[model samples]
Target chain A: MSLRRLGPVAALARHAVLLASGALMLIPFVWMVSLSLKPPGEIFRAGFSLLPEQWYAVENYSRALTASPLPRYMLNGVLVCGAILSLQIAICAPAAYALAKLRFFGREGLFTLVLIGLLIPHEVLALPLFILAYKLGLLDTYAALIMPFAVSPFGIFLFRQFFKSIPDDIVHAARLDGLSELAIVWRVMLPMAMPAVIAFSIFSIVSHWNDLFWPLIAVRSEQLMPPPLGIMAFKNEEAGSDYGPLMACATLVVAPLVVAFLAAQRWFVEGLGGGVK
Target chain B: MTAGLTFNGINKSFGGAHVLRQVSLDVASGEFLSLLGPSGCGKSTLLRIIAGLERQDAGTVAIGGRRVDDLRPKQRDIAMVFQSYALYPHMSVADNIALPLRMRRLSGMQRLPLVGGLLPGSRTTQAGIAKEVTRTARALGIESLLARKPGQLSGGQRQRVAVGRAMVRNPAIFLMDEPLSNLDAKLRVQMRAEIKELHRRLGVTFIYVTHDQTEAMTMSDRVAVMAEGEILQVDAPQVIYADPANRKVAEFVGSPKINMLPARFGADLTHAAGTTFDVRARELAGTAGTLGIRPEALHLAEAPGTGIFTGRVRLLEHMGSDLFVHLDLPHDGEGGTLIARLLAERAPQIAFGQTLHLGVRTGRILVFAADGRRVQPDPAPAAVLRSYA
Candidate 1:
């Protein structure tokens, strides 16, 4: 079936607007890449330029790799994001299933409380979380970086909507087939909810990987710093003029996520509507 | 050994909406019973209660002479085929059929992914499950489809896989909730016959639920008709259709529906629906009632002024074997129209707007009171004769 009807000129006009929007979305990344490839002095000299006059790509990338604990920061970023995403799924999936399917007394009231959580942004809780981490002696530790994001209300809500779309008969059939509620969650519902999980994985990993606010406030040591905080600190300590290595480090830090997203984009894009199909 | 199942005083409510009310039923072992009702009539809910999926608010459910109200669904030794088939899309037909057996026979560790394979004795249990699955699949004639996942199969194939799953358990009872509703008309008929034969071959208690009267009438040993959360009648399919216990059951079980004409019963003669016929009324003569006629009971007369109903043909629908005649009565008060199912060969070049006289056979008229309960008089002649000859 045809989804749209457009005359050739009208379609051309629509494509023009969409192309401009697409270019606009990519402009910052383009500028970052351009600055990363240019000689260190040319970054300061450039008013606006798409390409670098002299390619310092090898030197900038090599230096970015060698400089000041950047690799270790990337490793820590992976560890923190992986831990946070896995923990978020483990905690929220069953909770989401219960919220979507189970018939407890205060199910609605509890879900309302979780919905209210969406209104309270992470920024609102950052101060209290910092204080709590400090009191717990978790400052400068991976726990502080990973622990605050262990339960995402958005993840729970997304999974709950996805789980709700699954027919209740399948769950009842599983029950009659001798599966416990937990077995139904992991073995039955989880497999069916893979698309939702993939979509949520993208959300969790991207958000936690690029997060700078919590990491800057929580970590004091360079050893445990995530890439964003590490690169920001690297800029402060490095002679303020070397913008090439900084952008290159930023590129290195963000590349894994961009590549991973591109690899899984088909399912991620289609599955974002909160269903398997 | 297979055993009978019973629900005593079953009642349930969702918030303030009373869904099932004092529903009590008993099923003999090896009997195929159907709970036929329209949507939201609590037939599905009652079926779930029988399967131990839904808990009754105040009732005792007994399976195999044991009260199973406290038991979990798995403990109840019953299996169900959902209307949606509920086949795990990720699992192959073989795995879908084997799931129940594996869960029952294998330990949690033995059921794991990689570690389960390495565990001792897991191989033997897995082999045994495969054998049983193959046997069940072969029985359902779906052995060729066992290797494919449910997503790859058609609706009828998925239905067979579901039955194979339930069949593998060898449970004491089989509960099916409109299992054929998803299929088209031709497939529904074919699957209905298969289900009936399956019930005969299995010799286990089968409780089926559906809204389709044809399915219930054609397949079940007995049908329990329900409406508004209460059972109206429970009888053999033939009996339920021929002699429904109430107006609701009578109206619900027939195609084109039973033509019920509001009438008055007095002096042992029925008068209404533009036709006057003698009928024995169980109540007093002054009582208001309905005169019910099945479509087959009405036949075309040779001429007007000779038949009970004289009217103009409003519509005609021709089936290959039979024709449907819709007639507009002469004096229409509130009685809308009379519809008759006649053989195509018997209809004489009938057309819309043609005047026709219709005659009802003696002993074919059914009577109901103003409150819509069946009222049969002594020495009634219009009741269906169950021929013993």
Candidate 2:
């Protein structure tokens, strides 16, 4: 009857909605785990249950590991993501520094171009990038996989915003102390913007590790395929899909990112929060 | 290693708005010169031009009789302590102080992060730099803080570290852009003395920019009063106070502020605030001007008569040593307000609503023309004709 007493009911309602949405997001991952541990007969069973009556986790995991080089795919994912993240930082940090600190002609226009680059989806650039790769004879190679995502507009935007927040006094101080412009980026701006860097690393690793589209179009060799493409090898059209091994591969592929995100959750939040601040 | 600095017609503008307009100043070697002004007066901009941080659109900066317009900030042989004490947040205080030396002493290869320490000859250079950093830190009284990051130190300690960073290189000139403005009042006074002592010990030309008149008056050998992209006056601290070149300089350099009364000048007499005096300035005749009187220049007169201003006492502020008496003038005197400072013990009985006549001695009144330039008093007459009010 009183507004003060209605506070608890309102809070309960808000938490209930949040929990339901959280459950909705988590159901598919839970189902995948359940299916990975179930025998083939139970995967398509009518009754819904969390755990498999018969434990076939070992069999399903072994098949997923050996059937299509799932471990090799995860390794490839690490290599490709590592290379992309490094190249992105190297290219983006200086570009962002220039856009944020330096005064020059056409600077706003160049930054506008970067904003435009953010608006255009990577899927839209696939055809042109694929043709260029073919012309350059970079198809079916790690170069093709690593090169396309090297210059990330979002990374540049994130770093530029972060660099802009830093006072101009520091930049002037560095110059007076005999630091070159590039050295300022390496020694000063990068260290000061560490939170943004960690946040960007997580974003790049997650997006590229799970990226299926570009790798599918560019690389044909199973040796060079990233995790998403490697997992696609589990699907066979001739026979109905093998749900057990497929779900096992999906769980394995998503596991590293989840663990990494959990470990770096603090820096991740600080990094994104720093961008807005 | 010390040098004089000269700004020759320096000019700068941001987006078509002029920030510095043909501003020129000369700081003699070993002199402590302060660029005193309100904010946005382009003092910092001029200092930056000297440091080669910001390029002026026109004019050249010279140091030690050599033109340095084409030189970089590092090549200019000058150092600056920024207002924010812009110490590198990540680097320790030792590393921060050692940076200018390292940049000068080490090759690009030897300055690399991990492998540079292993480079041949770099070890010796680094040892020398370490010795220098420690010496500079000790001089600044921050040797114990060498291992701490700037974020861990108090504001005063950080300012000392910034000064140490500048002083380690032993440059020709030191340009400080309001370095003391960030400290608390007590700390500011303490550091003010320390900085003055540092200047005396180093004997380098210091171009300190500040908006605080007290800092300028106490520390600077000479002060250049600036306003709105122009220098109004440049003289010694005492001369700047006693003999300001313009009305702006008179109003800017004092704490309680010089009181100004609007006046009209006749052929041989000046009339102000219902009182007329035969202080002759024939060149300023037939024009309206301002009569500038400092608070200490005013004294208590016994009664309202010639050579005295009569007003009703509005307020009395007891300042321990001196009492400030605010007076409200009559309607014919343009309803002006005046403040006269009296020795507190001498004027103990002064109360609100009392009528007082304030008198000024001869030659104490500063006359300014309509354009704010000082109007020289006539030198021929040593005589003062008291006001026939």
Instruction: Point to the candidate with the largest lDDT.
Output: 2
**Which DockQ value does candidate 2 get?**
0.84
Clashes of each: 1, 0
Interface RMSD of each: 0.5, 0.6
For model 2, what is the error of residue A103's alpha carbon versus the real structure, in angstroms, after optimal superposition?
Answer: 1.0
Instruction: In model 2, state the lDDT of residue B331.
Output: 84
**lDDT measured at residue B337 in model 2 versus the true structure, 0 to 100:** 87
Candidate 2 C-alpha lDDT tens digits along B303-362:
887658899999888899999989999988787889888899966577799888899875
Candidate 2, backbone clash total: 0
Off by over 4 Å in 2: A1-10, A275-277, B380-389
In Å, residue B313's CA in model 2 sits off its true spot by 1.4
CA RMSD of all predictions: 3.1, 2.7
lDDT of 2 by residue, A175-241 (tens): 9999999999999999999989999999999999999989999988889988876567678899878
